[model samples]
Target chain A: MSQEIRKIEELARTIRRDIVEMVYLAKDGHPGPALSITDIVASLYGSLLRVNPSDPEWEGRDRFILSKGHACPAVYSALARRGFFSPELLPSLRALDSLLQGHPVMKKTPGIDMTSGSLGNGLSIGVGMALASGYTKKNFDVFVIMGDGELQEGIVWEGALSAFKYKLGRLIVFVDHNGWQSGASCNDVGGCVSVKSRFEAFGWHCQEIDGHDISAILQAVKNARAETNLPSVIIAETVKGKGVPFMENDNSWHKRVPSKEQYEEAMKILGGC
Target chain B: MSEYKGSREAFVAAMTDLADKDPRVVFVSADSLKAARATNFAEKYPDRYFEAGIAEQNAVAMAAGLAACGLKPYVVTYGGFITMRACEQLRTFCAYTDLDVTFGGLNGGMIGGEREGVTHQALEDIGIVRTIPGVKVFAPADAAETYALAKAAGSLKGPVYFRLGSGREPDVFSPGTEVELGKLRKVLDYGNDVLLLSSGFVLDRVLKAAELLKAGGIGASVVEVHSLKPLDADGVVRELERCQVAVTIEDHTVIGGLGSAIAELAAERCPCRIQRLGIQDVFPESGPANTLADKYGLSPQAIADTARALAAGKGR
Candidate 1:
């Protein structure tokens, strides 16, 4: 493995462990999507992102918006692991006193580019961020990760049109195509099987990549960074509950907390967890 | 008497002027540019303007996105449609996130297109909006006050709603005058006596009623309550406390507009005998603004009659 991939893989394992631990504590969280998105978030924060752990608000840092905000544990894991704050604060997730909320608060959570929980909102917010950057002549890029099912929202299309019209090359989006929503997949919801072609039709630089492959994920990010005229969408192919065998590809685990035994098994699967 | 402007046209003018001065000011319309009178804004700043074409949810969510990226977004649409149709995006994306976006609730009263249908009448917006936290709602009585409210909304520290009347109403301002948020414009104050409070397209009628009441020696005080959310609880108490009689008028339903707000305030702070005059019940059908105003008891003569009746009912 490349040193970069090795580091990212280790970080992803650690984040998966953290995800299992936190939800085991809270007894509530979207474990399936969180686990599915672990590698993506880990790779983004660990390898691809230009963020400062000490100063989350570094003016020149690339902005990130989790459009699929239900997978907040994934984000919180990445943020804590990257040292946005102490990793110990993970237990305080969604706690009354903790700044770390069930949904990311850009004001409270350092490095959270936007506060999002309501589905289909973060993409537009991300587009807004991209537009702001372009209008102000800021060079920083923006990344928005949305749920595959969230594409059903008309606002996503609105943001897509605006993004293309503005020619915001600095903007990139990743739709975590885990093939499930709160109820069904994008195909079952909207008959959209090919996210890459759909986004390309909407005037984006589109690509599909194995969301779990470290090298492929890294290359996709690299290709996205090289493009400079159109906003890009990387439809990451992923399995829900990617690490835990019993829950993988199952929608039931989309938000169900794991039992004590399940947590331990999950931890063991993500070795060096 | 304090000068007040009537109709949504004044709001369009203010947005146009701001769009001209600030390159960052963008007008995102759901094809109400004609009704919103934002054509000048579009003409003056084409690059900064957008048309969403009957897509209110998209328009609002896009506005939220634009606001997030540092673009001050003024979302223009009919009050009924914007509030009812695009409410989810407004509440979740804009109000909850506190996106820096201003809403122009055009054709605020039965005035949007009275004859068009009930859907365009926009009677329930005030009630629906009143429940939300941190949204500043204003029903401008005239054009000058609208520009003032729009300007204030642009510079506001948080989200704001600008309820506007349809154009073609007689201009209420005397060439130059403006109003501000959270501040009531005391039009005609008669000491510790009958107080007439009103808002939005109903202000002209209230002022006219004040004239008739003055002729009758009843001496009605006309207080224009343009801002409803940051309601003047103390000011309301000070003005209506122990007063034998007070009357409130609105073009909206009596449930949650300025009339209900005044009633709630008086009940909590200072108990007083107050009568609310607004749309009693049922959606208004298509008609001219004047005819609709008359039908709803929002006309000057109708309001004057209601005021006299309210005064008499209070045993004044």
Candidate 2:
């Protein structure tokens, strides 16, 4: 692997460690969802995104929205490590008065583009941001990450239709296709037949890639950015609880707190940054 | 009174005027642009206008996104759709985020959507929006008030919901009337034997009701409460304290609307005997707008009768 990819992989490992730690410390969070998107978050924050942590509200900065906001631990970790805020605040994941909220709140947290906790809302918000960029000639891209199960929401297709109608080239989305939702597997819950074909039918530029592959994730984003005439959706095939062996593809970890022994074992596997 | 005009027309004109002054002003429609009479805005500022194509949820969320990006967006559609269908988006995306987005909800009361029937009437919009924290709800009494409120909404910091009327609404306020946000506009102030608190297009009917009360030797004061969320609590309390009986008249349900707002305030501050003159917790049928309103107990005659009875201590 090249040195840059190695560095991003290392950052991704650290973010994974942070996600596990934050959820373990909070005693309450969606660990599986957070882990599923850790690499993607790391890939974006580590490289590609043109954002200044010091000036979080800079008009020229690219915007990022976490549509499946229960997965916020990953984002909170990435934002902190990206120097938007101190890394010390990572443990205060869902505490009252903490900047890191259970869901990503744009007003409370730096580097957050839109306040999103409700499913199927981020894409529409991204469309608006993309439209605003075209309107004001700001020339900033809007990135969004949604869950595979969130596709069942009717509003998601509405947003897809809007993005296509507007031809929002700067808006790129990543569907963390972990195959597992909170209740059961995505297929068991039904209606998520083919995410790629669905988005393609809506006239989006579509790509499918291994989400855990940092290089592949970056390449997909680059490919998305090249398509300046349409919105892009990278259906990243991710494992539900990635990085740790016992939690991998385990639906129980969707919201369960890690036991002390499990926590120690998970940390041993994740290792030091 | 000035020449009667449609609230939807006035709202579009105000928004178009705002677009002329502020480049960031944009309009998002959910396939209801023609209903909103916003073709002028769409024509003048083609780039700023967006259509979400029959998707109220997407339109609202998109507007929130635009507002987050420092652009003022107005999402115009049927009042029921904006308040009921996309209610969650308005609550979470706009109100929770405290975004500078305005919702122009057309056909705001029982008088609206007479041909389209019960499905289109927005009797519960005010109640739904009022409960959402940080959303300023304005049910303008007429076209003039709607214009002023729409313009004022542009300068306001957070989310606003304007409960507008159908094009057939009669003129209540004259042209160029300055509407202060969150303050009651006193229309008719006679001896305070009874206080008639009115909101939205029903103010005209309430005014007539006040006149009827006067003819029957019962002096009634009519106050137009345009802003329902940031209600003029102090002004309303002062009026309630003077009158022995207070009646709230609106084109919405008595529950969780203007009547409930007044009753909640009066119970805490003044403890006055009150009557809520509106649709009494029932769905209205499809008919002529005036006929539906009259059947639903929102007519001038019914309002006058209720106030007279309360003033004479007949119905305590």
Stretches of candidate 2 above 4 Å error?
Answer: B1-4, B314-316
Expressed as tens digits, the lDDT of each residue in B128-167 for candidate 1 is 7887887889887777777777766677755678887666
> lDDT by residue for model 2 over B45-83, one digit each (tens)?
899899999999999999988999999999999999999
Among incorrect, acceptable, medium and high, the docking class of model 2 is high
Q: What is the DockQ of each candidate?
A: 0.50, 0.88
* lDDT tens readout by residue for model 1, A138-211: 67889989988888887788778877877878898988988898876658877855777679788899989999
Of candidate 1 chain B, the 10-residue stretch with the lowest lDDT total is: B1-10
Best by DockQ: 2
lDDT at A189 for candidate 2?
94
TM-scores of the candidates in the order shown: 0.92, 0.98
Enumerate residue pairs that collide in model 1: B5-B142, B5-B143, B6-B142, B6-B143, B114-B286, B115-B286, B115-B287
